[model samples]
Target chain A: MSDLNNGRYGIHGGQYVPETLMNEIHHLEECYEFYKNDKEFNDELESLLKEYAGRPSLLYYAEKMTKDLGGAKIYIKREDLNHTGSHKINNVLGQVLMAKKMGKTRVIAETGAGQHGVATATAAALLGLECEIFMGREDTERQKLNVYRMELLGAKVHAVTSGTQTLKDAVNETMREWVSRVHDTHYVLGSVMGPHPFPMIVRDFQSVISKEAREQILEKEGRLPLAVVACVGGGSNAMGMFYNFINDKEVKLIGCEAGGKGVDTFETAATMATGKLGIFHGMKSYFCQDDDGQIAPVYSISAGLDYPGVGPEHAYLRDSGRAEYVPITDDEAVEAFEYIAKTEGIICAIESAHAVAHVMKTAKNYSKDDIIIICLSGRGDKDVSAIAKYRGVDINE
Target chain B: MSRIKNAFENKKAFIGFLTAGDPSIEKTEEFIYKLIEGGADLIEIGIPFSDPIAEGPVIQSANIRSLSGGTRISHLFELVENVRKNTEIPLVFLTYINTVFKYGTEEFFKKCNESGIDGIIIPDLPFEEKAEIKESAEKYDVDIISLIAPTSEDRIKLIAKESQGFVYVVSSMGVTGMRSEIKTDLESIVESVRKYTDNPIAIGFGINSPEQAEKYSKLADGVIVGSAIVKIIEEHKEDSGKYLKEYAEKMKSAMKN
Candidate 1:
């Protein structure tokens, strides 16, 4: 059984949702346990990951970046090469397949930057199940191209106008929907957050990133990297990138957070850096909240990382001192986003740029013999317009 | 027996819910006494949080209005203390877990005891996660009420078995909103809960009119009207107390019959 089933990472995770949704979560936990070790389930999931979503994504050496930083030899785990463009496809594929195995006819998900929603829609289309996605109204405007992509994939996109109309509100809207349709529908939660089974399930599916990267890095560099890094939002990619290297005590695991303008300003989503322990979205974790404990409205240029809360497991890791989290400003992320495109000819998602920004600043601290593998979580085609807007250019023109 | 248990002994109880400090604080204080005087057997006060995920647009808007009107947790507690001076009826807090956790769970419940509150209903804290808070609630003598919705199939028995104060049975499958019709086979649900424990059940969510209360009360020991009462506070503003008195009286009479 998964260690997370009891939903505690030393007092960080638990099912803190409404009683109306309790039975569904319990049933989900039971299903996850039964199928996790089941041979048939694993076999089918493995086949899908390999044939459909393109597993074993490359770990490419960033020679130009290494030279630019003038210190360590850097490597980028190209999760962007996955079929749906982001590491989110890894978890979506696993969840949609699980929904099929559980006899669910429909699947629902919430998205911020539209990456998770698109991945879910793609998986649902392949599995021949009905798909519905909830995106914040603000997100639909910011990431309009992704809205079109989801609709083209045959998923209905609901523009959630509630609350701040961002990822947090989208999560709230999806949870409400799931409660109403729990009988025949499954909520394909995008991140390693929310209630129990989800954090465990997403982490397990995404852990394959570090699993493959560890092997690839060993083959190429003859040893584990000095450090591994990824961006943290609801923290799927970071959790995935850090999971395998956790026990390798010498290997540092760092998570970069979107520090919109600055942590000193209210316009930030750096949960671990500036948040307090509070219960929201079914988990007791670090949440950006006001004095009264009400969830504070968070912000980031990268919509995907603009959530008020981090995954429960991330909270556990941070508290245990197993992993370190740092803030990456929007200016730093945008600079990295442009630099990688210019040097490596790769347009990376603004979300992934947060990690790249972290690497760009700290890579020079290590010697040339050191290896630093960063999780490049997604392609940036969906973010082209947003990037253009940030640069004061009209990409449409 | 607790006041909540005693409430169900005489006849079918009428439970009214309101988001404290909605419209204005003074009017909310007036509505509290009017709610009890209008025959509210038990009261559920809502501490408005920025994100109330379980609520529909009606209560959601009400929450927004209350929060924007500067309804702080401290203000709500003060109002609760004021209300305690007037009525000894069972009062429960219907709030999200974040608010209580923010206030410090043990501290929140301790204040509940000091201020004469009987129970609390956290819509986001399910049965499996209750142990942590339940310990604090027990130490403070505050009943952590259990809620069983229509979606709770086999788990109804489990929830009812461990429920304190009374069971809150959701009338429909959706969030808190008034519905013209409630099609769930609630009698069977009540029967399932009964197989576990003899806890008195109060049906809520989607109940608004006297007719709906009359219908649902037949299946349970009490009827909880939330969105309807909040809708009154939403529409009437400062004058909600007069309308709520008439509405609460009418609904309570229907539950009794």
Candidate 2:
């Protein structure tokens, strides 16, 4: 059995859900422990990840961007190539399957940019479970197309109109819903955040990214890269990519956070930079909150990166100095989206563009032959409409 | 005796619940007196939180209304302190861990001690994680109540062994809401809890009408009705005191048998 104590990423994670849901959480934890290593479950999950969603997404070298920057050689691990068009599919497949194993007939999830919701809805439909997604009213409006796509996939969508009416509120509404129908329902929480087992399970599922990237990088470069970078929105993609590299003592791990206007201002979503240690959404992690302890509303041009609190493992890494988390403003992320579109001919999601922006911001310091790998977590199709509006070119929805 | 233990003396305790600062702080103070006058043995005052995962829509809306009315945790402390001047009824805060954590765990507990808080019910803080505030709560002589649900079948005895003040036996499986009927096997659960400790056990959650209060009082040491009373306040708003007085009196009379 997987040790329940292991879920705590060094004084970070714990089960903080209400008593009504504790039984379900404990049951899920037990199931996760049993099935995660069970042969039949692993084989099914592997086959789906590979034959279904196209596992081992390419780690392509961006030669032009490397040459143009005249610094470190950059390669992107293309999670965008996966079915559902984002890295969220990786964890969703494992969780939805586990929900089935647990005898849950209905599945629920919360989304910020609607990527996770779409991915959850996709997995639930394929698995033949009833699916309901809770998205903040504001997010449903921001990512209107994704909302349509989720409904198209046969998932009922609930517009959450709670505090701030954003990602935080969506999670609150989802948890409340999960509490109400816990006996037959499973909350397919997205990202490497939330209570015990979730952080551990998400990291384990997402670790596939790093596992494949590591083998490819070792095979191609013959050595590890100088630094590994990924954008941190609830830190799933970054945790997945960083998990396999934690023991590679010499490799620098960087997580780029959404600076919104700037970290100095209250509008930022740079949780690691400007937030304090607090409990929210079931984990004791860094959160952007006010003096009264209310979860503060956060913003980023990239809707996905607008969450106020970060994953507990990210908090542990920041404290241990194993990873460096820095802020990138909305303007920089937008510029990087355009830059990567032009330089690499790959339209990266605004969320992933934060990582690209980090590379551009610090490219001057690294040696010309230094190598860098960026976990390009999603495609920008969903972001294009938002990006267009940002540039004052209102695209008709 | 602790105020909580004293509340259960002789008759089955009738616990009343209210969201502090709902509608307004002044009205909340008035209702506290009215609830006690109408025979509330103990009071559970809920501090408004932006995200209350354990609450149903009724209580959730009450929290939002309270927060919007300019209520803060500090203000609630002040309200409790003001109420302490006139009464000695047991009072406990029903809130999330974040609310206490943000106030500094030790500082929050110490203030609770000063303001006459008998205990706290943090729905989000489970048995395994109670260690987060247990030390501070103990230091302040404040009991940190543990909740037991029907789903807590295997772990009931373990939780009951260490339950302070009382074991809040949740009669239903879901969030805090008024239920017309509670199907959980309370006698069996209470039977399990009895083997562990002699600390009084109280059944709460989904307890609405006097019938529920009477029904649950027979199964445990006490009965706690929250949503039903909060709904009364929700309906009456500023004039909730008079209605709550009648509701609490009715509930207390039902529990007397």
DockQ values per model = 0.83, 0.75
lDDT by residue for model 2 (B151-245), tens: 88888877888989988998887788988878888899999999997988899988888888888898898988888988998998888889999
| TM-score on B-chain, cand. 2 | 0.98
Q: What does candidate 2 score on TM?
A: 0.97
How many clashes in each structure?
2, 0
TM-score of chain B of each: 0.97, 0.98
Cα misplacement distance, residue B216 of candidate 1 (Å): 1.6
Docking outcome class, model 2: medium
Candidate 2 stretches with Cα past 4 Å from truth are: A1-4
Tell me, by DockQ, which candidate is best. Answer: 1
Highest-TM-score candidate: 1
User: In candidate 1 chain A, where is summed lDDT lowest over 10 consecutive residues?
Assistant: A1-10
Candidate 2 chain B — worst ten consecutive residues by lDDT sum? B149-158
